[model samples]
Target chain A: MARVVVDVMLKPEILDPQGQAVQRALPRLGFEGIADVRQGKRFELEVEGPVDDAALARIHEMAETFLANTVIEDFEVKVETSEGPK
Target chain B: MTARPSPTATLNGGPTGRWNVRIGVVTFPGTLDDRDTQRAVRIAGAEAVPLWHRDKDLKQVDAVVLPGGFSYGDYLRAGAISRFSPLMETIIDQAKAGMPVLGICNGFQVLTESHLLPGAMLRNNHLHFICRDQKLRVESTSTAWTADYTAGQEISIPLKNIDGRYVADERTLDLLEAEGRVAFRYLDGNPNGSLRDIAGITNEAGNVVGLMPHPEHAVEPLVGTGRTDGLGFFTSILKKLVNA
Candidate 1:
């Protein structure tokens, strides 16, 4: 089994209106303890295949090309043997 | 008897010489819909040319399209940084010369940022990233990019963005209304707190148009919403080119 992790974020310089809205609303909801809030999506996929470096690279490419907009977001992937000690 | 090829086929290079309508799709650093926009242009029987933000020339394309996507990651504001791209300078000149230009979502933001269109995009009133099938009424059929649509014709398109709300000074809004420059109006409900449910607008010359919807994504019948309402935008330009 192989694992892929994907993260999506608005570009740093971009104004995140959604994040700002949540930050302003937090205090009103009695969550005054929160200082900052940035919203993003995270996805993890488990694939069944021969876990290899080539396969890991393909997964990363797919994420960058379609899953995540590299201009505003970046992602990292990890692959490991699903079972047993080496 | 030999069968004659359809005019469209001949124009698009079937038996006759190449008649592809060359369209340039501008890609800003954070643009998200450049590829999809190119595909849609191809489907509309036009040749799609990929244009870079740094390029000063428009590559001799007949028309230009600014695809939706966060340019410069929507830095400072949506389409703010992208408005300064070298390509926009050429587009501004070409648009003044009556070249048809269409802007979608983030592209719309860029048009506004460049002052190619009036009004500004602000944070949505609900203040959330909205992705939905939105209904819009075509208010003007005079724009080069909207000629195929009928006035008051309601169509559905995909709208997605955090700062998609449209805002303008009251006088500007009034002038737009008086001059019939308002190209589209939101129907059903306003997804964003746009003043007067305005969804899109066109320039005074009717050559430049901008809208906060993903018309490219709506062209394919089997896609997300399975609605072809947005296809009219592409067809309109094609018709305009053929007539010209």
Candidate 2:
């Protein structure tokens, strides 16, 4: 089995209020010099068979169609690993 | 929420019986305002039919209302998951074919997700859930849901939500303004930081309208802040369907 991952984030031009709130609290938590922060969602998928280019393409389509609202978000799909777990 | 009279009997003595005009109110799993929307429809002298999200049929209703609520628990995005529901497929097809559809609050988010309307809703700039009575100006009376309201008329309706800000590209905004597709604009100090104070908008054909405010809550004069300003939406569509 193989694992695929999709990371979704709001477009750079869109406002992310939740991320901003977290950023505002970082200083109080002793974090410093963080230029910016943006909150996003991550989806992990388990493939039943070998992770091939065709599977990647299908996952990309899923990201575009259901995982992300392209109007305000951008998503990237990556193959976490090509081999099954030990 | 207040204790309100049952909607089983309408004040108009059931004109729906004579006109045969039935309006559908769709309910998703997590929907909360479907009943109020049905009551609004009944008060407008039309039959209110309940439509389930999992069902593909629209029950032969002349028009449909997607009421406010956090469908699918607003997971992933406000309306992303619900837009893929079986009922939305039919809505999208019918809406494209010139059927009248109204989306309120979270319903507006679904319309955007379905691509039936442009732009997506974002979290309020202040990062807080706001609930209040909001004033909005009727900008375009040409839409099926706004014909009973004269242009430039300011009305107060209940607005509530966390994701209520509307955003779109500058070109699309300009095009909407140019074509008079901007159906409503926030009047008194933008409530949720919507772009250009846009409270509501209509599709190119004016059959689909989506807004952040809860017009269904303000339809009855005795309930919901005791204002009937929102009844114009239902009445407007009733006239349009009857006349058409």
Instruction: Tell me how far the alpha carbon of residue B143 in candidate 1 is from the true structure, in angstroms, after superposition.
Output: 0.8
Candidate 1 overall lDDT versus native? 0.81
Q: After superposition, which runs of candidate 1 have C-alpha atoms over 4 Å from their true positions?
A: A1-86, B1-18
Fnat of all models, as shown: 0.25, 0.88
Put down candidate 2 lDDT per residue, A1-42, tens digits, no spaces.
678889999999888888999999999999999879999999
Where does the lowest 10-residue lDDT sum fall in candidate 1 chain B?
Answer: B1-10
Q: Please report the candidate that would top TM-score against the real structure.
A: 2
DockQ for model 2?
0.84
Chain B TM per candidate, please?
A: 0.93, 0.93
Once all C-alphas are superposed, what RMSD does model 1 give against the true structure?
A: 13.3
Cα error, residue B113 of model 2, in Å, equals 0.6
